[model samples]
Structure formats: structure tokens, C-alpha cells
Target: MIDGVRAILIGDATLTGLVSTKIYPVSAPQKINPPLIVLIRKDADPNKCKTESGGVGRLDEIDFTVLIMSLSYGECETISERIRFLLDGFQGISNSKDLDIEYETEFDSYSEQAKLYVKNATYTAWYKT
Candidate 1:
């Protein structure tokens, strides 16, 4: 099934240590699959508009989203091996439940992270713990 990872993930602490992600199709068989992690950060302003009729402004969370994709077929045959292979060389993120992330801007916490590794074809979803 196409699993959905819904999280207002703070940019930086994503798919690092104990946190894992997996993505699979709905028609596919069920397995002990991890969730697929995708972090979408909103770099724009929180709100810049005014109310029109209702006067009830549409409030939005001044934060970004953490997307965790699902698993697919064929990969299951070698999921274990694949997971191991991908972990190679990559440093292990701290096992802290808190997002041990640091920002560079005055409000860096609001800025999320999105990194794609072509060599591994796997995406990294970063967020605070």
C-alpha cells in the first residue's frame, strides 16, 4: 500500500538513526516494511493574505511536512541487503528521540531539509527527532 508519512517534521532530523521509512503499493503483499520518508519544507512566508467574506482567516502551520514513502516490489527480495548497502559509509545519526538538528539562520528551525542521493537512488527525509 502507498503508505503516507504525515509529520510536521522540523527540518534537519529526518531518516537518520532509529527513524526509518518504507514505501509500497496497496496491491502488494504486506511485510514488515519501514515507512518511506519524504520531508517537504515551506520556505515561504506563513501568511500574507487577509480574510474576504467569512473574516475567518485560513491559518496554516508555520512549518513543513515530512513525507515517508512506501516500499515496492522486487526490492523486498533484497530489502535486507539493500538496507545494509545503503547504510554503508553513511554516518549514524544520533539515536536521540529529539531532533538534534542545528540551523544556520536566525530562524533556521523553520527551514527544512531535502537531499537526494543519485548513487543510491534513495532519498533522505530529514527532521528534528
Candidate 2:
């Protein structure tokens, strides 16, 4: 599912203008440029599914945490906004599978160690398995 999220974010011109294919899964490389996007898979569980056959279909509910990190707080905010606009309430085909994504929660923090302002956004995505 992280691949799907990366596809959506990187596919957007607005977001690419800001990050320029800097989206990474889990974490970015050391000393890389700032104002990048990182995707983290939090967890996944089976959700009750239904089909016309009156049988339970394979449906999975996954939680993903997206981190917008940048040396400048303003840049972080800009990237965060673009990501939110693209991902919130998004339902479509991604990675050759149908997906339903929704924004769940977010928070702002400063990582003094990395010296980057971070905007953490979490989303719930449901898809057939």
C-alpha cells in the first residue's frame, strides 16, 4: 500500500514541484535534501467484507503514517497541505487495485535531532486482498 500512496503523491504535479520524487518508504537517505516525503506503514487488519455471493471477501484495512519533513517549517506545511489535499477522501484505482483512503489524524512536531520540522499525517486505507 505504501507503493500506492507513493504513486498518488509522486503523480501529482503540485506535490512533485515541492518534493521532486523525494518520496521514500520508511525513511530517506542520510544528508539528503530536505522538504521530502516519507511513508510508513503502521499496521493492517482484516475488515469484514461482503460480496454478492453472500460470502466474506478478502478486505484489508491498513493504517499509514505520512511524514512531511523539511528544514524549513513553512516548506513542511506546504508539502503537508498538498499531501492532505491529494489523499483525503481519495477513492480510486492504485497499483492496479481498488483503494479507499481517508485522512484520519495529524500532528506537528520538531525533530531537534534531525533539526527538521515534521508534519505527521495518518490515513486509513481499505482495499481488497
Cα shift from native, residue 27, model 1 (Å):
26
* TM-score of each model, paired residue for residue: 0.21, 0.93
Off by over 4 Å in 1: 1-35, 54-129
| lDDT by residue (tens digit), candidate 2, 1-129 | 789889998899999999999999998998888888899999999878787799988789999999999999999988988898999988998877678999999999999998989999999999777
Please give the distance, in angstroms, between residue 86's alpha carbon in candidate 2 and its true position after superposition.
Answer: 0.5
lDDT of 1: 0.29
Please report, in order, the local distance difference test score of every candidate based on alpha carbons.
0.29, 0.90
Q: Which tens-of-lDDT digit does each residue in 1-129 have in candidate 1?
A: 002122212222333332332322222134443434333444423333345564544323222333232343332223323333443233324334212122221111111232211112222323221
TM-score of model 1 vs. true structure? 0.21
